[model samples]
Target: MLRSDDLQVFVLTAELGSLSAAARQLELSPAVASAALKRLEAQLGCRLLVRSTRSLRLTGEGELYLPHARSALQSLVEGQQLLAGGKATISGTLQLSAPSDFGRNVLLPWLDEFQLQHPLLSLRLLLADRNADLFRQPVDIALRYGQPEDSSLVAVPVAAANRRVLCASPGYLAANGSPRTLADLVHHNCLRFMLAGRVHERWCFLDDRHRELEQLVSGDRVSDDADVVRRWALAGRGVVYKSWLDIAQDVQSGRLVVLLPELLGEPTPLNLICAHRAHLGERVRLLREHLVERCQRLIQLAPFAH
Candidate 1:
C-alpha cells in the first residue's frame, strides 16, 4: 500500500514542478523532500521525474502516478472535511490574478463581499494585464478575459463582457465628421492599442450580417493602456477602439461618444481559470459560484448588455 505521506509529497512535487517548492509548501527541507521522492520511486521500482538544473519534467511513469497521488490526497482531504462536519470551514489562502482594470473596478468589489461572507478565507490578488502562468506562479485561480487556449488549466466561464468599441469625443467627431461605414475609418485618425511587439495595426468589425471585417486602421497615437486611450479620446486626439467596460463611464458622462456603433461586434466571454487538480475543494467551489453569480448580476445592469 502506498503511504499517504508519500502520496502527499508526490502530489505537491507534481503540482509545484520543483522539490524546493514542494518542500517549502510542505515545510520540509529540500534534501528530505528529495529523499521521500527517491524512496517512493524505489518502492514502486520506477523513475518518476527527469530533473535538470533549471526544469523538471515528469516521465511516463511519473505522469501515470500523478492522477493516483492527486486522488489519494483529495480523498484524504474530503475525509477530513467530512469528519470535521460543521466545523469544516474553509480557512486557507487563495491566490488570484486578473487584469488591472477589471481587478480594480469589478473583482475588488465582489471580493469585498465574498470576504465579508467568508471571514476565515485569506486572499492574495494580483492585478496585471499580462497572462499569468498558474503552473509557475503560486496562484490558486486566475480570472482571464476572452477564451483561454491553454489545455493544461481548467477554464470556467464566469462572465461575458463586451468587446472592443470604436469611439471618440464629440468635439473630435464634429471636426473629423462621423464615419458612415467601415471603409470610412481608414480615412480617419484611429487610435489603436498596440499590444507591445505586434507590427500590424488591424481592427476587427462586425457588419450588419454579423460577418467579421478585419481592417488595417491607422493613427499616429498608439498605446497599450486602455485608460490612456480613453484619456486621448477625451482630449479629442482621435477615435479609439477599447473595451466597453473601460469606456462606459466616460461614454455615460458624455466625455466620449460611441462612433459608428453599428460597426461594433459581439462581446467576449470572461473566464476563471485554475490548475487541474484531481478534486476541487469546497472553498474553490464556493468562491467560483459567488463570482459567477456576481458577474450575472453585473451583466444584467451593464449599459452595453444588449
Candidate 2:
C-alpha cells in the first residue's frame, strides 16, 4: 500500500513540473519528496518518472496511473472531511479565485468574518477579472458571474436573481441628463469592462414590450477590472451596466442614479464553482451556505428584480 504522503508528493511534482518546487510548496525537503516518489515507484515495481540533471517527465506507466492516483487522493480528502471525529476542529487552507470588484468590495468582508469564526483556518484569495483554470490553478473554489459553459465544472447558483442595473453618477446625470429610454443610451457616454479577453461593449436589456435587446454601446474608457468601471461611473465618467449587488450601496446612497427603469436588463447568475465532485468538506459547505444567505440579502437590495 502506497502512503498518502507519497501520492501527494507525486501529484504535486507532476503539477509543478519539478520535485524541488513541489517539495518547497509542501514545505518538505527536496530529498524527502524525491524519496517518497521513489518509494511509490518501488511499491508499484516500475519507474514512474524519467529524471535528468535539469528535467523530469512522467513515464508512460506513470501517465496511466495518474488519474487513479488523483481520484484516490480526492476521495481520501472528502472522507477525512466528512468523517471527522465528532466536533473535530475544521482547520485547513481554503484557496479561492474571484472577480476583482465583487471579491474586494463584497466577498473580502465575508471571508474576513469567516476567518474570525474559524481562527484555525487559513485562506488564500486570488482576485482577478479572468477565470482561473481550476484544473491547474491552486484554487479550491471560485466565485463567478454567469453560467459557465464547461460541462466539467460543478457550479452552484449562489445568487440567481442578480441583474445588471443601468446607472450613472449624480454628477454625470446633472451634467448630461439621465437616459430616459433604451434609445437614449446611445446619446450618453457608455462605460465598458472586458470579459475573458473581449470588450463587452454590447449591453443587453429588455425592451418595453419585454423583447431582448442588444445595443452596441461605445465608451470613452474600458478596463478589464470591473471595480475601475464602477469607480469611473461614480466619478461621473459615463453610464455603466452593472450588477445591482455591486452598485446597490452607491445607488442607495444617492451617489449613483438608476437609468431607464423601463428597459430591464438581463440577470446574470452568481455561482460558486468547483472543479471536482468531492462533496467539498464541512467548512466549504458551511461557507457556501453563508454566502448564499448573504448574497440573497444583496439580491434583495436590487431596486428592480424580475
Candidate 3:
C-alpha cells in the first residue's frame, strides 16, 4: 500500500504543475515537496516525474499510477467525511476565489457574518478578475460570472446579472451628445474590456422588433479591469459598457445613465464552481450553502442602490 501522505503530496504536485506551487498551496516548503515526491518515487521504485528547473512533466509510469493514487485519496477523503459527527459542526479551511469587484462589494462584507456563525472555520479568499483553476489552485470554491467551461468542475448557478449596457457620465454625454441609435455609437468613444486577447468592441443591441443589431465600436481607452472601465466612464473619458452590478451606484446617483436600456439583451448567469472532489467535505458543503443563501439575499436587497 502506498503511504497516504506521499500520495497526497504527489497528487497535489501533479495538479499544480510544479512542486513549488503545490507547496505554496499546502503551506509547505519547496524542499518538503521535493522530498515527499522523492520518497513517493522510491517507494514505487519508478520515476513519476521528469523534473526541470522550470516545470514538471509526468513520466509514462507516473501517468499510469496517477489514477489509482487519485482514487485512493478520494476514497480516504470520503471515508473521513462519513465519520464526521454531523452536518451542523464543520471545521476546516475553505479557500475561495471570486472576481475582484464582486468580492469587494458583495462577498467581503458577508464574510464577517459567516465567520461569526462558524467560528471554528477559516477562510482564504483570492479576489481576481481572471478565472482561477480550482484543480491547480487548491481552491475549495469559486464564485464566477458566466458558465464554467471546464467539464470537470461542478457549477451551481448562485446569482444572475444582466449583460453590460452602454453607460457614460452625464457630463460626457452632454459634451459628446447621447447616441440616438446603434449606428451613432461609431461616432462616440466607447470604452472596451479586453480579455484573453479579445477586445469587446462590437456592441450588440436589439431593435423595436427584437431583431439583433451588432455595432462596431472604437475608443482610445481599453482595459481588462471592470473597475478601471467604470472609473474611466465616471471621469468622462468615454462611454463604458459595464455589468449592472458594477455600475449600479453610478446609475442610481444620476452620475451615469444607461445609454440604450431598451436595446440591452438577456442577463448573464453567475455561478459557484468547485472541483469535482469524490467526497464533498462538510466545510465545503456548508460554505457553498452559505454563499448561495447570501447571494440570494443580496440579489433581493439590491445593495447596489446608489
Choose the strongest candidate by TM-score. 2
TM-score of 2: 0.84
- What 10-residue stretch in candidate 2 is worst by lDDT? 84-93
Per-model TM-score, in order, reads 0.68, 0.84, 0.70
lDDT of 2 at 157: 86
Please identify model 1 stretches exceeding 4 Å from their true place.
Answer: 1-79, 86-89, 169-178, 225-237, 249-256, 277-280, 301-304
Q: Report the poorest 10 consecutive residues by lDDT, candidate 1.
A: 192-201
* lDDT (C-alpha) at residue 188 in model 3: 90
* Higher-ranked by TM-score: 2 or 3: 2
**Model 2 C-alpha lDDT per residue in residues 1-306, reported as the tens digit of each score:** 889999999977876789999999999998999899999999999987898879998887877666556657756765676677633355666778988989888888899888887787788899998988776566778889987778888898888888898999989988999776777888889999998789998888887788898888887999999999999999999999998878877888999988877777778788888876663666677788888899898777776654
Residue-wise C-alpha lDDT for candidate 3, range 233-256, written one tens digit per residue: 999988887666556666778889
* C-alpha positional error of residue 160 in candidate 2 after TM-score superposition, expressed in Å: 0.9
Total clashing pairs in model 2: 0
For residue 108, model 2's alpha carbon misses the true position, in angstroms, by: 0.3
lDDT of each: 0.74, 0.82, 0.74
